[model samples]
Each structure stands twice: as C-alpha cells, then as structure tokens.
Target: MLTTAPFTELAAQMTGRVVTASDSDWDAVRQAFNVTADLRPAAIALPRDVDDVVAAIAYARAHGLRVAPQATGHNAKPLGTLHDALLVDVRALQEVAVDPAARRVRVGGGVKWERVTPLLAEHGLAALHGSSPDVGVAGYSLGGGMGWLARKHGLQASSVTAIELVTADGRFARVDADHEPELFWALRGGNGNFGVVTAIEFAVYPVAQLYAGTLFFGLEQAGAVLCAWTALLPDLPDEMMTWIKLMRFPDIPDVPAEVRGQAFTIVFGAFLGDEEDGRALLATLHELGPAVDTFAMAPPGVLGDMAMDPNDPLPYLSATALLDELPDSGVEALVAAAGADSGSTLTMVELRHMGGALARRVPGAGARATLPGELGMFSLGVPLDEASAVTVQAELDVVSRAVAPHKVGDYPNFVEADTDARGFFDEDTWSRLRLVKALYDPSDVFRGNHPIPPADVRSL
Candidate 1:
C-alpha cells in the first residue's frame, strides 16, 4: 500500500542523511541509545530542519509508516525510537542559541544538554539541565526532567517559552501556552506523543559559579553518612543541591582504585553560594570522614566533572520510582536489597532530593498537568549483567517495596528497557497527554519505543 516514491521525494527535500535498508550503514543506524534496542525500522530519516521533519512526517503518513523522533537516543529512547517504524534522527537539527535579552535559550531538539550548558555558562547563564549532559533536550523535558537544577528552577518543562514541532500531518507549528495550549502542555511533561519537536526556547538562570562536587565514602559508613546528610539538607541553603549515589565503578582509569570495582556511598553536591561558606558547611561532612571527599565550590563546568557519567556507548537498562516517604523501614529495606556494601553488580543507584524550586509550578506556563508532589524519595535501578537483569530487578523491587506505599510515580527518563510505564504515572497526566495526542497527532502514526497509551485504552 505504501510507495517508496514519497520517501524518496521527502529525502531529497531534507538536508541531513537518510538511511534505508539498502544502505550499508543501516545495520548500525537502527539501534537506539541502548546498544541492545536494535530493531529494523522501515527507514531512518535524519532531518536537518523543521521543513525536513515536516516532509518526513508527510511521507510516513502517505506510506502508512509510523514516526519516532530522537535527540540523544537515550532515556526511554523508545520515546524516540519507533519500533518497525520510520525513525527520524533529528541530531542534525542540533543548535543552541542564547537570547540574553530574554534570558532564554532556543535549542534544537537534537542538541544535548552538554552542548547547551557550556554555551550558557559563557554568558554567565545556566539552564535547568538534567543530570547527564548526553540527554536530548526534548526527550529530557518531556519526562519532567528532574535534574540537578530542579531544586532551584523546578521542572525544565516549566521553563520552556516556545517549541517548534512537526506534527502528524506534516504541519510545522509553534507551541507556547497561548498558542497550541493543549499540545504545549502535553509535550512538556507528557512523553513524546504530540509531534516531533524540532527546537525549543526555554529559560535559563544566572548561575556563574558554585561550590559543588562529590564526596565518596566507604560502604561501611553508608548509615552514618545518610543520617548526617538528612540533617544537613534541611539546614543547607537552597543554593546547595545534593544526592546520594550507591554505585560501583568498574575499575576504569577515571575511577579510583579503592572505590572502583566495588560499591561505595557517594554524596553528590552543587553548592551555589560562596566557596568559603560552602566549605564551612561541608565541615560536618568531612568530620564523618568519607573515604574520598572531593567536595569543593566550583564553576559551571565543574558539575559535569564531578558526576562524570561515561560518554562512551554503553548497553544499559534502568528503572525509577518516586516515593512520598522514606521511612526507617524503607531505609532498612533499601540497605537489605540494594545492600549497604557495594559488591552488587549495579552500576549506580541515584537518590535525588526534590522540592525547593521543583515544587513551585509557574502560573499558566505549560500543559504539564502532571508532576509528583513535594519532598519525596526517588531511586534508580541500573543493571550491569544481562543474565542477572531480572534478578537485579527483583532485588530492586524489594528496595521499592521498602517504600511502595509511598511510591507516587516513576521518573519517565529512568524507565529504561521496560516499555510498560503506563502503570507508573498518574491517570490525570495520562488523560491530559492523550488529549494532546489527539489535538496534535491524532493518527497515532508515530508510535515509537515508548508508546503513549492510546486514549481509548483501559488503565493499568
């Protein structure tokens, strides 16, 4: 029923590369972020601009092909990689422009946070970016990006001023609350269901420097450190942000020999205030005597150096949950399941503190009708062993149950290999997202790795 003519014509209209089954590089191009998500889509369109994206959508609709959009090919990469679908790799659209006058930045959907971060830093500005700079801006914000700046700036979606999208019918449209109100809302916190976003204009902050870095502790001191951290967080200035990571680095050069190849308690921090004050505040942390305390007040780029997640292509899978409470029982369960000691093969388990700016939603800003409430716990489950992935999940589930009653929702970005995330979020959010899907992409022609539940479907 579909003809190659439309695709051929559409490909000619685009500036970037177009890959098909006949191409020699097709084998390597189809796989999404996770090396394991290798599926044979009908074709892959790497469009350079909004017009190209629009044409690709037109061709896909004519050919009865589904569409998917990807920026970084990470996260529910399915959020971008359509299965047996026409994959639109928008990386060529990558561009970052800062509007100092408006205190905003307009970035191509394909641009990663890394590309945007340093540019903003050059201008004494900062975007409420995610933890890792590798994630695509669109996919990251669509999942309510609860990243490092979250405590100070709230959801990244909340800051978006404008968005350009290529819709189901191949129409290019601009999105803002006053414009396509419903679709705008859905694209913010809702997973990619509305259309293929080409670029986004969002707010940034004047974050010139900060006292920030990580403090690594021996596994034996996890409990004492956790208590000390809890006491410190409430008292610390809002400028400071912190998270606890229980992970083992796999004996890599960048990793320390003592902490590498084993588990440890690492305190990740970002102190936005003066260095001396920040250092003084850390006195208690040092008194606890961590095995490796790498704490310091630093410049904008320092955040990247401290967390330093691997940029190399990695085959990974993860899961996440938001907790309303972290009871003593929950702590015990986490320690029991994930273990206080880090011999487990899990790469990292990150627990971010939410609230502060994360709690306040901008008035009439976006169609982000959904977000978890204030001051809850969050957890990430990363599996290192393919054979043991299931077992690792079982153990993580134990940690999850330790605080299940308090689980409000799952962080969309962390919904790794699992595609059944409909059960993780709230119903209102789902309904709102579906309404946006109807308004902007009624054909359901773009079902990718992360399929938005059809509006008519039953709830999980």
Candidate 2:
C-alpha cells in the first residue's frame, strides 16, 4: 500500500486533487470501465490541464512511483492497477478545436469523440472516430482506430497531424511526421509506451450522417448470411464499411419483439457517401429476409446500439485473430467455434471486412499490417464467470491456432486483455519501438496502458 505521509507535501503543491482510500469517493475512483479491473490505486490525481499532468508526473518520479495515464477508461484494460500506482486521470484536459478550413481536429487527450463528432457535423465534417463516443480521442486514435468511416479515411492514426506528449524523462515534446519522426512512428501503434499523450491533431472528413444500423436475421440463417455477406463486401466502394455480427438480443420488452431473445445474424454497415448509391450497393442485403431492419439514417451517438456491445461490464473475455485468407476452411473453423448455433456461450462473433482505403498507407505507417485486404478480422465476445478466464483463453487458443495461417497485425483492442503490452507487437516491430522509446523515455517511465515492454521484456 502507498503511504500518504511521503506524498502529502507533494500533493499540497499541485493544482489537481489527490485522492486516496480515505476519501469518500475512493470507490468511484477505483471503478474501471470493465468491473474486472477493481483496483484501489494509491493516488487518483485529476489533472485539470497539461501543466497539472507535468506536476503529477514529476511527483511520481520524485517518489519513484509508477504512473498510469488514462482518459475515459473504456479499453476493458488492466494496465494501471497496483495499490501503489499513481493514477493520472486526464479528463480535465478535454478540448476540441476544428480547423474547418483545413479539415482537421486537434482534440485534447481527455476529449471524447462524441464531443468532436457533433462539432464536426456542424461544419458538415466528421473524423473517423471509433463507434464508442464515450471512448477518448487520443487513446483510441493511438491504437489505429477502426470504425464505420474507417474505410473512407484510412486508419485514424494515419490522419494525425501532430501529437503532444510529456516524455517519461519529464520533457514536453510536440511530434509530427517531419519533427521527432522516430517518436511519431511509435505513437501510432506503440500503445502508450513512450509517454503521456496530452493532445493529438488529426485530419477530419466531411460527413454529416449515413445509411447505417443493423439488419437482423434468425440464428438458423447465419451460415447463409455469412457466405453472401463475404462475397458482396469486396465489391463495395471505399465510402462504405461492412461487417457481419452473430448475436443474441436479450429477452427484454425494451428490445423489439422480433429480435428479442433469439440468436441472430445482424449485418451492420456504414456508408460514408450519398444515400442513393449506398442503397444501390446494399440492394442485395436488403433483399435478404431480416426479422428486424433498423437500417436507416442515424446519428453517430446511437451507433453503439447496432453493435449492442454492453456498456456495463459483466464477466467479459474475448479473443480475436486477423486473417490472411478467409477461405472456406477458415470460415468453417470460425462457424464451428462461435457461430450462431455453436453452443459455446459466446455472446457475439464479428467478422469485419478490411482493405478498401485501408490498403493506402501513410508515407511511413508505423505498423506493417501483415494482412492487407478487404477480407477479414475476427471478434468473439464471450461472457462467462470470472473463474472461466483460463477456460476461455484455452478455447480461444485453439481458435487462434486454427486460423494461424491468417495471422496479421493484432488489434490493440480485440484481444487487449489477453496480451500484455509486450506481446502486442512482433519482434522486429517491438525492437524498432524500443529504440524509439529509449530515445524519448530515457528515464524508464511510461509503464502504463499499452506500455512498451522493458528492453529485456521486448527482446524475449
């Protein structure tokens, strides 16, 4: 446990409040997006601005404390958990400024995409932010965010105009493609390995709304839907992104009577272009028999309902794989493992179609995506008891092996909890990342979320 005595002097010096277990709000502070991450951090420092973050980090460094930088807390993560940890909550750092003329948005690390999306919409523009509006802008973008408009704009990170980070060694640096180039490479997909990113500026797209939402089908029809969906997605325009989801809507009156409480296949899509062309593109899917057709013009805020991903944590565990070829054999393995009728207690199996604009990389994109195409990405959401993490991992291991022939760049998100920061990047990638980390964070700080594993850890 962290003693308050040693840090009382330091706490009195900062503008942000320093809370400990003695505070009545300690329970609230300990709560994470995923309830599984129930940990009492030694100090919860609410930094009101970038200067506050600097002060908090300096205090941590002075006391040899571990610092975990967080915003929105939506990653279902475990990077900052120790009782002795210094929790740097960046929520007060929220800022969203749109350079409408330049087609860009410079969002503070603490800002949620929801705040920016609407502001951009006012200018008849939108950034390719993730589905969850509750998710932080900088945190998600740094992971190469994937979302509905992703195909049209490419990786969110690729849109980055600049990033401002407080290096581990306690120096503030603003990096971009042209300046501090090495640090820029690691920031894109290196997770939060190098330092605390306080602000990020990325390119925004002109988009108001789209033909988006779910088209649901019965569980029995999942196989047929998957086959047809895969064949149709590759022919899609760059302005559209498509995905197939196998899920079971809960039995509740709030849910429509048609899709409530039954295993179903929901085709969720987003078309970034005009409506008429989008409808023509989706004519084939519209022909398919759906129990419920919630597909229509919708705002970005409600997009989460389409995926129906739980906002609250239950016993959540998931594993995913990137595929090189979505051949019949691979599809067969997928269906057998987590299909509609596969009684594996899995909540949903999602197959996201990649490629399209995704193939075009920034001049020197950080992560060398091993698999590049308009074909596949796998997501299986399973909810079982906490004790079943081992069993779920074992089952997922089998599934990963079954599709090993298709392994590509791992999703920092899909399998986040399963792999530590070390395993997130491959050897060559991690090696290059370490050299950059050493250059920026020479004092061995930045050991929080999506951390750069130690030189020893990365080498192994």
Off by over 4 Å in 1: 1-9, 76-83, 252-259, 279-283, 340-343, 373-386, 417-426, 448-450, 453-460
1-460 per-residue lDDT for model 1 (tens digits): 5445435677787777778888889877765667656656678899887878887888778777878777667853454334446778888887778887678888888888888888777777778786777778888877677667777777888888888887787788897878977777777766666678888989888876687777878766766676676667667666778888777677777676666677778888887787788778767877887777676655676564456676656666555677655655556556665665534456666677776776566786454523564344444444557767776666666666666766777666666654665664566766767766765666687664456755753333
User: Could you tell me which 10 consecutive residues in candidate 1 have the lowest summed lDDT?
Assistant: 373-382
Deviation (Å) of 382 in candidate 2: 5.4
lDDT values of the candidates?
0.70, 0.71
TM-score of each: 0.89, 0.88
Instruction: Tell me the number of clashing residue pairs for each predicted model.
Output: 7, 1
Task: At residue 238, give the lDDT of candidate 1.
Answer: 63
Please give me the total number of clashing residue pairs in predicted model 2.
1
